[model samples]
Target chain A: MDTTSYNNPEQGNQEERLWNYIDGTATATEKTLIEKLIESNAEWKEKYRELLEVNQLLQASELEAPSMRFSKNVMEEISRVHIAPATKSYINKKIIWGLGFFFITMFIGFLIYGIGQMTFTGGEESTLTKNISKVDFSKFFNNTWVNAFMMINVVVGLFLLDMFLSNKRKEFRKQA
Target chain B: MSTGLNDNEIISKVLSGDHQAYAIIVNRYQNYVFTLTLRMIKSREDAEEVAQDVFIKAYKYLADFRGASKFTTWLYTIVNNTCITFLRKKRLDIQSLDNEHVFATADNIDSGMRANIVEQKSKLAMVNDAIGLLGSDDAQIITLFYKAEQSLEEIAEILGLETNTAKVRLHRARTRLKEKMETHYTEEVKNIYN
Candidate 1:
């Protein structure tokens, strides 16, 4: 009986260690210890040989290659995802210019509305001192210039609201 | 090997929109991936599909790969999971040695003599059949250890098991395979000598 075998007689219990050994997963220290044991152990040596034979049989087995369309299919799926969206030059350019003009017009209109409201209110408060609450908009509506300005304001407000709503919808769609 | 770019370098290039850099990674590991998938799925069609899925998935998740381990290790983890999922969906039953005794015996003789012209083909088929008999975990352990050449530590990480556990699973799988082989051998010998 080999001395090493006498020391480690239960060879079957080391089957897991043998697998780790074949896989090169054992730590350096553990590997050295196992190696030293194998050197003096006949049973371990025999077990190692049997495992090596199986390993070789497995290695000798040929692996069949996948079909040529494999990579192509993968690329196709990836392309569907990562490929950039089509560039719409006309629509994009139009939207950019339209947004710029819309913002500028809104700014000017806001400034005009602020100034007009301040001036009109400041003058009306003093001019209509006699029961201003009872005063009606009939006279103001009869004045062509006042009515024309009011009508223009309403149209511009509606136009601005339409643009704002449309832009909001576009943003929502983009998020969706 | 010195001149070849490492996986990290290739990954950086890919992230920077060097789309073609992906081919390098694919070429470098395609065979390993193909072999692993083939061994696991056992069907050429399914294996090819799974292998391609693995590559595509690895490509998509490349940015999330934090370099905690080798790229091959990470990739095998994905491949292993993909095959396992496929196997579950297919609901393939484990092949039993008793059920396949006749074919297994013939295959054993064919494999033992190693002399038949179709020995390689038959042996591959037998292994595949035997692998089909094993539980999913055992089959995966056998493939990762023997076919993919993955270390037990790497397999542990992939399978979410302790290193010792992976080793034990591998040992058990091998023991089962050997027993299967032995039974087939005995049957074949009995037939021949009697």
Candidate 2:
């Protein structure tokens, strides 16, 4: 009864449709149609049995095992090579939190020091607050050490930006 | 294989410097990895070598596995690629999945193993031989679907195929396996129906 070549276009279509049904990928209407065909058409019925048997046979086949010493050999091979420690092992959370706390404390201390330097002069009767923009920033900006720090910060920021952009470019290249 | 630890737990232990814990992973997945390698490479010796390379490669890069996908997905991806590389180095025709050279290698393995097991599991033996007759691509897809029990989506991820393409390939692979069974093992297939 299985005389037709599987490569025959019609036969391939039949097999594909039956496979979709077997794999549960077919729509409800297609499923009903296939069921009716299997019930009424001997060809569909035979094809269904063959395909189902193949599915069952595949599921039943045992996975091929390696030699009894396979794992031992792998473990032995691994022993000779150095494996790096896990990520959590090397990174110190305490140091990270300590740096974070120090930065926060320094930021707040600078804000408080700057605010303390501001003087609010007021007359009792008709006073608007003094123009804060007139407060001299030249004293802070003129320190060689401060200027050096700002330059260092700018250079470091640029370096970090370059690193980040390069990494993003590498990721884009990989995806493409 | 069950060291009372799941894959993630084992991975954590291995990462945390319990190098011995990797043995649990090796024991757990060796057969699976070996089977996949064998299906693709078609030689037990080369498959064994490649399977070992796969495990070692996975271990070296285990830290890179981010758990974005199942661990098996990552591991099988390594297996699939390693086999492809092995085939390429040998300069085998990978694109021609139905090549006689590929099928002949499978036949050599199946013919030797099929005899001793025939009395106990003839049906399984027949199916295994029929699968050996299939090209590496078809065999890998079938093994992934049935033996590994991977969903089509996982198969897609492992094979680097679109989900729809994976579905179609799986359908076509099974169809070809059916054709092989019908053509090569008609007697056993008849027995299955009876």
Candidate 3:
């Protein structure tokens, strides 16, 4: 909301704008206009007085302060927390990026080198295709145990992620 | 990380192994945090626990404080959040249309409001009672805005509200506060007249 703009009401609907003026958020021109309007218009004057009274009352009372030992108890609790050192606490993004760059460069360089030195193990067949040709897919598909194991791992991973996310959500709610 | 330093500086010191420096932060912000918690929770004992937990959380996560906001604002966020979490866990936040927090502060005030101070005390008590009648969010907004001395923008950020939304809420809250004050004060006046 462009709240800083001067809102000169067109008609009988400037409550929000009037509130902005009362909140001291109105532009200078808007403030001048509001002051003039409050002076000339009885309704505006009454509304302004009501807002001013409420503002004063809200600003009047202070909440109760805790006992003298409040800080002491906090300090005692803080003494037990294991604070991580500054350097180790925040991860270095540069290192992560550098490692990523290094790995990518190495993979590309090795690929170029491997491609240059490549020789087909079978006539007109690359090493990858030759290797694929040697694998038997029938035994793996025929076995239900392998599928069950994979499904269990998937379910467990999902369960773990769900638990982790739920805990994170709870922490976030607490923070909010 | 200097020993005698500002809030961010003290936090840095605490982060950098000057554990004792946290005492400075705790001492400085305890009352403000306590006041906020006390208002929200409406009980001294629970407010005390919430206030202590606020500092502890701040201490534990001092490193995570991005310093995008003022330290007091950040600390207050913790205080408010802790109170809310405490309320939920304890399930003791029914409104009950009561004025315990209001009258409690009233009792604490102006024992020394003496003769000249009596009128002022009465006025203050009326206002305070009106404040007590406000909802937790409204009362919290009043406390944060006036007592904590935070700007509307800062309050918006603290309360996860848009600036306009916060302004509207504050305006409505104040309006409600005024109604409560006037209603109670009028009743008192009538009683006196009677």
Top-TM-score structure, candidate number: 2
What TM-score, to 2 decimals, does candidate 1 have? 0.56
DockQ values for all predictions? 0.11, 0.30, 0.22
Give model 3's docking category: incorrect
Better of 1 and 2 by TM-score: 2
Point to the candidate with the largest lDDT. Answer: 2
B-chain TM-scores per prediction = 0.73, 0.88, 0.78
**Which ranges in model 3 have alpha carbons more than 4 Å from their true place?**
A1-16, A84-176, B1-4, B92-121, B187-194
Off by over 4 Å in 1: A1-11, A17-44, A59-62, A83-176, B1-3, B93-135, B185-194
Of the pair 1 and 2, which is ahead by lDDT? Answer: 2
**Residue-wise lDDT of candidate 3 within A1-176, one digit each (tens)?**
11222233432246666777877789999999999999999878866665565566556665566787777777788778976444445688889789757755765564454444444345555577676665455555445654565565568568779889977865674487
Candidate achieving the largest DockQ: 2
Name the fnat for model 2. Answer: 0.59
Clashing pairs in 3: B110-B113
- Compare candidates 1 and 3 on DockQ and give the better one: 3
The TM-score ranking, best first, is: 2, 3, 1
Q: Could you estimate the TM-score for every candidate?
A: 0.56, 0.69, 0.63
Residue A46, candidate 1: alpha-carbon lDDT:
69
Give residue A171's error in model 1 in angstroms. 45
